[model samples]
Target: MKFAHEFKETLERECFPDHWLAAAIPYSQLKKCLKKVQRELESLGLDKETLQQLLAEQTVSPNGEPIPLVRYNLDHASSRSLRPCLSIFVHLRHGQVIDAALSPASRAFLQRLSGAHSRPSAIDSSACTTPLATPSPDVSSDDNDEDTEGELERIEVPLVFDGEFFNILQTDVDSLDALQQQEEKSMEAEIKSLGAEVSAVVGPPKRLAKSDLNRWREIFDLYVNAQVFFSSHELDHGSRSSVKAVQQLVWFQKQVQTRGLLQSFKVPSSAVAYSRFLQLNATLLQNLKFQEINKTAITKILKKFDKRTSLGASVTFRSAIRSRNFLAGSVAKKLCAQLSQEVVSTVPRAEDYDCPICFSIAWYPVRLRCSHLFCVRCVIKMQRENKKHCPLCRDEGVMNADLNNIDKSLEKFMKQYFRKETEEKQRANEIERGMEIFGDQYKHSSCVLM
Candidate 1:
């Protein structure tokens, strides 16, 4: 059936992607094919106006953006009674379309329409002139014929990524794991060599304090768990591959609700930190492989925190000792980067990284004095409007100082980890700018006459 004008308008209003709409079978073409059974359809009490209304009612569902329609032929239609029989077409991503069947209705009106079977063969001559197929009461027609008969029986539409893509991802993950193993061996060799040199020069190496080793072990624990989490979370769903980042996120989120891996693991920090750590590292793991852990950064943090229990060390230490929290932002970055390897994964949930106001990941991130974060461009706009307080916390006197010192850590993190999302956010921002500058002509970029 043809899509109603209202239906098309609704899809357009929702900004359904143009490439997707272009790939589907046209509504007009489907309507043309349905006309072959027009006489039969009318006999079943479905005139043109009534059919149009029915088509319009089922055309636009709110389940997904622009909704999905099913249109397929019935393989067993000749043996059944005809009432409100419909064909279905399931739309999958990247232009794959599959045909399905519509379920039979049990309404009183449909029962009346198909009641002619109860009478003898002496009904109207017109009914004999144009015979229609009957629909089966016992069989559910919603399932497709081919789907029921195949190995992938009763599979839903929007099929997962093919085997080739999964193989590629698996190879990449294996390579990353191998690389991490090599790095560990190299580090071990370097540590042995350094120990030999120190023993020759300083008589003999001193025994390490229990506290210092325990702290490093805590940091290492956090690193290992984060690695295991990012590595296996995608593999939790057996065999099937997702074609889109959003789909991966949606499936993973559902799995997280049912079977969480981190809830029971005792970490050096709060349980909430485990989720945040997984999210942060998982975002990085999608695009990068495990490399050498930043040992220099870790060492610097550890040295500053380690207490001077050794006799001679107490004289050199005058200031207060700063203990490192392995879960802290700075330390976690160094540790997670070293342990986690990048593999096939989704673009991170935008809410985890985006500034709440501008909703973009670009244009200089600024951490407010009170710890609220925003993009610098948005901050300037706030200043111009005399919004002197932090929008989130409502803390006053933000305008007292020039808001400089861009949050370089966050900015660098976004640039390094979220390359794909950065491009998307920038493109959306550019489109917004174009609309403001070019007015109505922005959409008609190729119109030479204008």
Candidate 2:
């Protein structure tokens, strides 16, 4: 999908603040904004869903009628192939006031567009002759040949920006280029200096004289790569100092894997140890954006490997060699955090909003003293069963805690984020209530014994 031309114009004219433009305007942010709008419209006792259905029914144009565009790309949580390619399309009516409070960027963008531009297209009709984007032809058409079409459908999004935003971006790009050039020159000088130092070492063995220089170069380059990954130069010396141990382990592993030196180094491949290593790597990657990694934990793995390596290799030949910061500056850490935690789909993760015991979207959710959340009904059931501990935490006296004390914030989060799930739960509850009041009609046979 491509954003409408008017939408682009709206964003440019809005001149949203910088922070609002974070994460490059992901589709989730746009949907969240529209959902809030839907909620607000619902608050006025006008069902937007029903109104839209009526609008579609009454409208004369069958094919070209405006329809709500809400689609998401669902990918596995751990998939690396996912990219921010989803597009949004919104149609604004005249005098429709949009509040820019959903996100800093979204709010400012919409508010600016609403205030500056009143028309559908800000550009002159003669300059832009392309008609408004119609619904995709494949949607309603009966053509089977479209399935065999060789080319994938493409969306062209035009770059739109006013003078001030363009100038700011240009300046940042210029500064980054200059800094990169300076760093390259500095690194080149440092490498030459190190080479000179290696030559100056007196009484060095022949291995150190010839073979070791190449080894040293490889090791040095690995360190350079690690520094680049961590952006060590941008960090203060103290922060850089803390990562030294981790940096060394990363450097050593890189050398062994790249040079086929694992055999020479006698690195172990015990199943248990390798399993621990993989586990640690997965955890580190997942929480890498928010937490300082477990340096001591990594050190333990290396030490174990070092001890095993000294014991020498087994008689059995193994040919394969496999290779694989917690927070400072929390605000920046948080901004980077989004790159790691992606929403897999429009539907929220069930585990996040559901009660562990009931396996349903929690109603009247309450956080225990131990911070585990469960619905009020579940808590009551626990109390009635003479349970004195929290089902999740097993904390004593949890049943004595007030059931009326609800986590208002978490409730709001569930409502906003899990709208579809909540609606499904609500419908189920209604059916259950009807069955309880009227008795289950299908519980017994309907045949009479005349």
Best by lDDT: 2
Q: What TM-score does structure 2 among the candidates reach?
A: 0.24
Evaluate all candidate structures by whole-model CA lDDT and list the values in order: 0.37, 0.38
For residues 1-450, write the lDDT of model 2, one tens digit per residue.
334343344335545334323312233333333344344434432233433332233211123344322111212223222111111223222333221112334334433544453333221222222212322456543342343211111111121211122222223323333433443354344334433433332111242232232333333345344541234454433223224535644665666577754233222322222233333333333333212222222223223322322211111001111111111122223322221232111123445578898898886687888888887667766887889887776897656668456888877776655555666765665565567667886232234898
Stretches of model 2 off by over 4 angstroms after superposition: 1-339, 342-348, 401-403, 430-450
Tens-digit lDDT track of model 1 for 354-376: 78797767446778888777766
How many angstroms is residue 236 displaced in model 1 relative to the true structure, after the best TM-score fit?
23
Q: Over 4 Å off in model 1, which ranges?
A: 1-350, 359-363, 397-403, 437-440, 443-450
Question: What range of 10 consecutive residues in model 1 has the weakest lDDT sum?
Answer: 150-159
Instruction: Evaluate model 2: give its lDDT.
Output: 0.38
lDDT of 1 at 34: 34
lDDT of 1 at 440: 51
Task: Report how far residue 424 has shifted in candidate 1, in Å.
Answer: 1.9
